[model samples]
Target: MVVLATKVYVSGDAYERSRDALRSLVDNEIGDLDVEYTIGVREDNFAIVTIEGDDEVVARNVLREAYGEVTPNFEDGETYLGTLESWGEDGIVLDAGRDIEIPADNLGLGQGTPIQIVERFGLVQHMPLRFVYREGDGNAGASELADEERDRLYDWTRGTGRVNVNSATRGEVRATVNRAGHANDIVTVERLGLLEQSIVCKEGTDPPGLLAAIGEYLPAEIRCVIP
Candidate 1:
């Protein structure tokens, strides 16, 4: 069994739709192989995938390559995917099975407190982020966003025409955009987390315009990443 790095925080009908979407995603990734798989969402919101077949090892490797795995223990100098749990004056807490606190000083993005950085980046609660773990005294591990990773995320905002939506499954978001008749405005919807997604706007399309077109149907917080 392999736990997906992404989190699933949606509930009710959206939850069921998200699960079905996840299953289809996994199937698209490794269904051609001689393996049968089952997808389950844990209490902590991580997706657990169990594969059984003679080619299970190959299927497992394929999944690990596509989606980072959620392991119980993390090693120093290695990067892992973690969900944003909470933010405080001191730092941001990530739920990576264990709570990993990233101090404000370690956030090398720019000059700002944790909360300000969260706002500038439009980071949604429960959104998954990549972090590198470092070994500290007593074998405790400290995780922080790498400078390169921070730059990459920052670059996303540098580009105009991206709508960042939170608290809705990818399926729901896509449906809303289509139902709202703004499907052509979007080039693609990138999945940031299970419930957090970024809608990449096509050329000549404004992010705010796309948001306003679909906002009425989504019933979730939608923010624009203006350049």
Candidate 2:
């Protein structure tokens, strides 16, 4: 079983839809392989995929490549994936089967507290981020956002702009965009996690304006990334 880094925390219909979508995604990821798989979400909200068959190893690796895995151990200086859990004036916490804190100084996003950077990057809660793990004293561990991950967030600012949202599926976000009559204002609805999404705005489109137009239609938290 490989535990996925992303979370599926919403309940009822949302949970079912996310799970169905996730299953379809997984099917597409390993459809060519000779493996049978089943998926489950742990109490911690991390997803686990159990694979069995001749091509299990290959299928598992494919799943890991598509969705980073939550391992039972972390080697010093190695990179891993974690879901954003909470943030404060000090820093942010990631759920990697355990609490992995990336303090403000280590965020590498520049010029602000952790929450400030989160806002600047339009990061929604539950989004998966990559980090390099460092072993610390008394069995404690520390992590910093991986260089590639930091680079990815930095790239967002160079784009037209985006509206980050949480507690909704990609389909729901897209529907909200259409319902608000600003469907043509977006380039795409990018999935950040099972419950997190980014609405990439088109050139000359205003992300804040887009957010205002669709915010009321979504029963979720929304934030804008202005360029």
Candidate 3:
């Protein structure tokens, strides 16, 4: 059994749809292998995947490579996936089972406070981020965003025509864009969290224009990151 790092925090009809989507995703990732798997969403919002088959080890590795494994303890210098729980003047707090705080100075994504960094990265609440935890005395166990990860997010802001939408599932956001008759305006909908998605506008397509066209169809709040 492998506990996935990410959470599935939706409820009602959205909950069911999200579970089905996750199951399909897991199946697609491990279907070709000689493995039979069952996926269960826990009350704590994490997904538990159990595999039993001839190639269980291989299947397990495949799943881990696709969806990071959730561990009960953090190791020094090891990168882990965490959800953005809260932000304050001190720093950003992540819930990786325990509270992992990344100080504002450790953000390393440029100037500003923790809140400002969150806004600059277009990070939505509960969105997952990768970080490395360092062990020390007082501030030891403090986490820092991985340099490569921070650079990847910083690069996104440099490009124009990206629409970042929060509080909606990828499936729902994609359906909304299609229903709004602006499907051609988007190249892909990148999943930032279980609910947050970033719509990458197609070449020559304006992000703000695409957001305006589909704003009415989506019930969630949408924000645009202009280059």
Which candidate should be chosen as best, given TM-score against the real structure?
2
TM-score of each: 0.89, 0.95, 0.90
Q: Give the TM-score of candidate 1.
A: 0.89
* Candidate 1: 10-residue stretch with minimal lDDT: 134-143
Superposed Cα RMSD, model 2: 1.9
Residue 86 accuracy (lDDT) in model 1? 95
Q: Is candidate 2 or candidate 3 better by lDDT?
A: 2
Per-residue lDDT tens digits of candidate 1, residues 76-153? 898887888899778898888888888887777788889888767767677778888877732244568866769867
Error of 1 at 77 (Å): 1.3
RMSD of 1: 2.5
- On TM-score, the stronger of 1 and 2 is 2
Model 1 alpha-carbon drift over 4 Å, by segment? 137-141
- Report lDDT (Cα) of residue 48, candidate 1: 91
Worst 10 residues of 3 by lDDT: 134-143
- Reference-based lDDT, each prediction: 0.81, 0.89, 0.80
- The stretch of ten residues in a row with the least summed lDDT in candidate 2 is 135-144
After TM-score superposition, what is the CA distance of residue 6 in candidate 1 from its true location, in Å? 1.4
Clashes of each: 0, 0, 1
